[model samples]
Target chain A: MILAIASGKGGTGKTTVSVNLARAFDSEIQLLDCDVEEPNDHLFLKGAPTGREIIGIPVPEVDEALCDGCGECGRFCEYHAIVSFGTTPLVFPEMCHGCGGCTMVCPVKAIRETAKPIGAVETRRAGNVTLVQGRLDIGAAMAPPLIHAVKARLRRDLPAILDAPPGTSCPVIATLRGADFVLLVTEPTPFGLHDLTLAVEMVRALGIPFGVVVNRVGLGDDRVHRYCGQRHIPILLEIPDDRRIAEACSRGGLIVEALPEYRGLFRNLVGKTMFRTNPKEA
Target chain B: MKVAFTVSGGDLAAPLDSRFGRAPKFLVYDLDKETFEVVDNRQSLDAAQGAGIQSAETVARLGAKALVTGHCGPKAFRVLRAAGIGIHYAGEGTVAEALARYRAGELPEAAAPDVEGHWA
Candidate 1:
């Protein structure tokens, strides 16, 4: 089963949950960090990337010689990246979505496509889990495409744990695609509850079964718990607030590896998640 | 020579539209023939991005030699400048009042764009 660990708000311990859960699986499991804008899972994982690949999108390049400025490309382009004012076409590479419709609509064949680097995806083996991460270039708005590239390497034979980007927008929606089950990670606070409700609405609209994992459980009131109970959503696991866990995380150490005590907790969490996602197999 | 005035409506009595890209309409006035035409700028108004450049392209296509608006971003300014179209800045008022200012040579030529892109 492909389970995605997602959070509506940032810094709610999604990487901590994802990495720890991946370690719980003894078999060959895949871990895909779909947060291309800022992937931090590699910090806690061991080993260097065995394979590296750069990912790019095709942006339009115009030929001024064989062209009349019909303004057709500008009129046809929905993104407004390409436009012809007078007899010259101006292209903003940063705004191009790589749809290739501009080139196709060019009557004079003056528009051609060129590769524009968006980001890179690196693959490595970190103990029992194979970690794959997509890192986007700074100031690039192409995170969704690179995230797709990282997910394209999922191993069907093994269970894939996807760590999604924060929020309820394009990047988050892109990562949620094809996920068998979603694990919504959130803290038990007012902001957390507000964003979590939005996330729940998004997942429900996507029609994916999801459960909540409340991190730093005792730090806030039981509102998140109460909300979940009212909605009848399963509480997968609750990791208590502890300075020791924070200290380990700050030093880029896994909670399971440093404490050794929480290894079973994470393992049990994984098992419960698997059972919920696939009751027949469990 | 023809002059383009960004407007809120499609008539002479329409108020001047300060927004260059998202203006509802443009009045293309001919200096020689003393006739004018209104061009729909609703497409640029609804454009997701590059509204300025698209509107500038429309102005160029209509063969306007000058532009009268309250604001112009750097991108749209570049497009109009490259098309050899002169840009002038006018304050918020009726289109007829703006035209009177233009005819009386009260408006100043903008050396650079007055506002940033997507300000409207």
Candidate 2:
């Protein structure tokens, strides 16, 4: 089963939950951290990556010598990344989405497609789990393409867990796409509740079977539980505010390994996810 | 001058329709003329969620001289500025009230939205 762990807000212990869960599964399991922009799971995982691959996107490069600056490329680009008037054509790399529209519209073929390295995907062996992660290049605005690159390395036969980026944006959608189930992690706070609603809406829109994992459970209100109850979404696991766990996270350690007692919780989380994903498997 | 207003649906004056691309039933008033033109923004694309630049382009294409809205990001701000459109920030109350404030020149000119990513 491909399980995707996602949250709408940052700092919700998503990496912690993912690492611990991967450790608990412990047998040829694959963990793909699709949070390409700020991947931290590798910091907590075991040793250096065994494999690496660079991810790139094709962006248009204009050749000024070709001929007259007709401004057709600028007119065709909906992003306005390229704007030409009279004799000059301004190209803004940051605004470019790599749609290749400019190259197609240029009558003189002045625009050529060139690859720009956006990020890299690294695969590391963490005891039993194979961790695949994407690290975006600094100043790269686009993330979805890099996320797709990381996910493409997923091993189909083995169970995989995808740690998605925060929020209900395009990157999150790219990470959660094609997953059998999604685990929405959130804290029990007002901001957490608000963002959780957004995530829930997003998962529902994607039509993926989902459950909630309330992290730092005792630190805040029970609104999250009430919300889950009202919506009939299952509460898979709840990790309370434990100082030991925080320290372990700081030291790049998994909760299941640091505190042994939490192993069962993660195991149960996997069990619930499996049952929800495949009722016949139960 | 014709203008477009960008509003996230959660705003009080935001139209009842959830289709974000459609413009809410709001008016862009001309303070000099003392008259208002109810701008139909239904045809414009929504920028409230993702791709602010695209939304800014939609607003610009609508021939808006000024944009009134609650919040905008840096990328969208740059695009709007490049289009030569004035921006008004913290526009509250009903859409009409905000337009009145714009007409009265009471609302401060909005500074460019920060360019840092939303997560940061």
Candidate 3:
């Protein structure tokens, strides 16, 4: 089963839950870091780089020689990536979504596809886990395309865990797509609860079965639990507001390895999450 | 020469909008004809992104010789430069006053984009 760990607020510990959950499993698993803008899972799950591939998206390139300046390409683009003033259409590579709609709409066929490198995905073998992380280029606004590239490397046979980016934006949606289940990690603060509500709405809209993992439980009030309980959302696990976990995380250490006593919690998390996804299998 | 001034109201008397890309309207002043026209720019104002590019295309298509705004972004600057429309700096005045400043050679031509993209 493919499980995704996501949070609506940054610093809510989505990466912490993802890495620890992967380590909880004794068997081999695949972990994908879909937060291309700032992928930090590799720092905890260190391994020699096994493979690397540059990710690119198709952007339109207009040929002035064959162009008729029909202004059709500009009208076809929704992002305003291409614009024409009764002359040659200008192409802005950064705004292009690589939809190829402009190229198809061009009557004179002056537009052609060109590859624009946005980021790179690298594969690393971290013990029994095969970690895949995508790193977007600096100043590159396209994170969804790079996230899709990292997800494309998923090995279907092996159980996969995706560490998604924060918030209910396009990048987060891209990471959560096609997952068997999602683990929405959040703290107990007001900011956490507010964003969690938005995230819950997002997952519900996508029609994906998901559960909540309340991290740093003692850090704030019981609003998160109260909110989840009222909404009938399952509280799969809760990690206390412990300084040990924080120190371990700061040193790029996995909680399961640093604190062996906490291994059982994450181990139980795997079982509970799998059972949530498939009641009969568990 | 037709010059475009980013404005916030319907006529030449409207306040000059400080923002160029997301300005509410553009006052196209025809210096030769001594007349002006107001072009609504609500489309660029509501754009999620690339408002500057769209605004530049609009001013260029309207045959503006220069754009007078409080600020200009890199993307809009490039497009305006490509269209041979010079961007000039003028703020804290009405559209008609800005146009007068342009004709009087008081408004300075922007050598480069005054601010980064997405500047408010």
Candidate 1 per-residue C-alpha lDDT over A1-282 given as tens digits, one digit per residue, 9 for 90 to 100: 899999888888899999989988878889999988889888999877799999999999988897798888888877768867657787878778888998998888988999999999999988898999999999888688898889889878788999999999889999998888889999999989999999999998888888889999888789999999999888888999989999999999999999999899898987887646353221
lDDT of 2 by residue, B11-113 (tens): 3365323122233533444556655555454433433333555555566665677877666676667667777778776434665566657768886777767
Task: Decide which is better by lDDT, 2 or 3.
Answer: 3
* Model 2: interface root-mean-square deviation in Å: 4.5
Give stretches of model 3 more than 4 Å off.
A275-282, B32-35, B108-111
In model 2, the clashing pairs are B3-B64, B23-B41, B23-B42
Candidate 1 scores an fnat of 0.46
Better of 1 and 2 by lDDT: 1
DockQ of each: 0.45, 0.08, 0.64
Can you give the lDDT of residue B119 in candidate 2? Answer: 29
lDDT of 3 by residue, B1-120 (tens): 999999889887789999999989998989888888999999998998999998998899899989999999988988898889998998698887887888899987889999999867
Candidate closer to the true structure by DockQ (higher is better), 1 or 3: 3
After aligning candidate 1 to the native by TM-score, how far in Å is the CA of A225 from where it should be?
2.1
Extract clashing residue pairs from model 1.
none
**Candidate 2 DockQ category?**
incorrect
Give TM per candidate. 0.83, 0.71, 0.95
